[model samples]
Target: MLSVVIPLYNEARTIVRVLEAVQEAPLPTGIGREVVVVDDGSADGSADVVAAYAASNPALGVRLLRHAHNQGKGAALHTGIAAASGDYIVVQDADLEYDPTDYAKLLQPVLKANADVVYGSRFIGGEPHRILFFWHSIGNKLLTFLSNAFNDLNLTDMETGAKLFRRELLQGLMLREKRFGFEPEVTAKMARIPGVRVYEVGVSYYGRTYAEGKKINWRDGLWALWCIVRYGLFS
Candidate 1:
């Protein structure tokens, strides 16, 4: 089975849509689905929406966990990951930036190519992407480059949200970062695993604007850079 770990903050506007998309998403035959949603103390009723949806779709394997106060995305992810029971795990952001339809495509490497980890790269492919935020794009590339230099892995999008991994592999790692720093921290640690087969596949992106509810900012970019140096160079 594939465990979809969705870590959400205040995303009430798009929570239901994303969850429905996940439910409608197709997976390869023989691979079952279990959704683990962690609500990081959303003030916008995101948790309630999830509860209503889960109650309505009783047959769906949906588990909703909540944090009394807002923690970072990584913390929420930690909660969901600890509760996951699938053979493999994938991170899904609650926002509409990533498409749930790409789950199967990202899982292809693990399911067929013997990959222990797979990253969906938004920088590649001919798929449609919302053309916005040039500086953000540069920030992503610079972070990816720095991470690749330290970890020695040629990944196109280290900041990507869609990362799939073996359940044991992820649960075993000592992930400490609690916010946007999770990206670089995980990438650095995962690179150190012996004989770990990591693959990257091109995936579509529908990035949101700040006015449209985007939360990541320049501060997170700086945090990611620090994470790269701290985890990558030291460990």
Candidate 2:
């Protein structure tokens, strides 16, 4: 089974659409999917929306978890990960920025090469990508470069949201990030693991602008830099 951990915030507007997309997305043959949606105390009724969807679509295997208050995306992820009952795990956002159909692409490495980890990069494939912010793209590349320099990796998108991991390997890690810094922290820590086979595949990105409900900002990028250094160099 592939456990899709969706750490949702106050995204009531897109949560239901995201859920439906996940349910309709294609997966590898013989593989089952379970959605573990961890609501991070959304005040916008995102949790209620998810509950309604789950109740209506019981065959989707939707499991809703709550945090009581907004604890951050990483915190929600931790909660969802703990409750996941699958052989493989992947994080999905509540927003419509990422395509759930890419799960098959991300899983190919695991099916063929026994990859322990697979990161879906947005900058390497012929897939369609929405043209959005220029500086944001630069910032992402800079962070990925710095992260590679520290971790001795060559990832094109270290901060990608579409990452797949073996459940046992992911659960064994001591992830400490509780916010947007989760990307860099996890990448650094995953690189340090001995004999871990990490692969990267290209995935499409439908980036949103601030006016369109994008949440990340320059401050988060700075925090990501600090995280790359802190986790990659220190621990």
Candidate 3:
């Protein structure tokens, strides 16, 4: 079984679509999975959508968690992870930027080869990038480079939304990041542990503009940089 964790913050436009995608995904035989949505104090009607869906489909076990105020992405994910019920866990964004169909590809290594962690690397050799934005792409590459430097592993996309891991192994780590810092924090702690194999699989990513509820801004990039450094050395 896999627990699909989605952190939400005013993602009403895409939350329903994401939920539908997760519901439609064809996980392998005998694979029990759960969709856990964490609402981080979204002022919009995002929570309502999740509740309505869960009410309509009782068998899906669509769990909804709420935060009174706006916490960060990491906090929301932490809540969902604690409530998750599955052997494997995957972090999914509640937006249409990523394809939910790629869950199978992200799980192949972990399920077949007994991998400890699996990341969806957007830069892996596959299809060409559909969007053409140099500065944003460069920033992403730089973050990935710094992450690889500290973790001692070469990866194309370290901050990809799709990350699958062994449920029990991660739950024991006691992660501390509660914001955008979650990415580097996970990489740092995972690096400290031995005998854990982290591999990146090719995946598709669609970049969105600010007009479309794109929350990550220049400030968040700075926070991400700080996270990479702080977690790399101190954490």
Best by lDDT: 1
Cα RMSDs, all models: 0.7, 0.8, 1.3
Q: Compute the lDDT for candidate 3.
A: 0.86
TM, every model: 0.98, 0.98, 0.96
lDDT of 1 by residue, 1-235 (tens): 9999999899998988998999899999998999999999999999999999999998996899999999899999999989999999999899978898999898898878789999999988877788998899999999999999999999999999999999999999999999999999999999999999999988899998889899899999999999999999887
Pairs of residues at least 3 apart in sequence or in different chains that clash in candidate 1: none
Report every candidate's CA lDDT.
0.93, 0.92, 0.86
Please identify which of the two predictions, 1 or 3, would achieve the higher TM-score against the true structure.
1
Misplaced by over 4 Å in model 2 are none
Candidate 2, residue 111: lDDT: 98
Sort by lDDT, top down from the best: 1, 2, 3
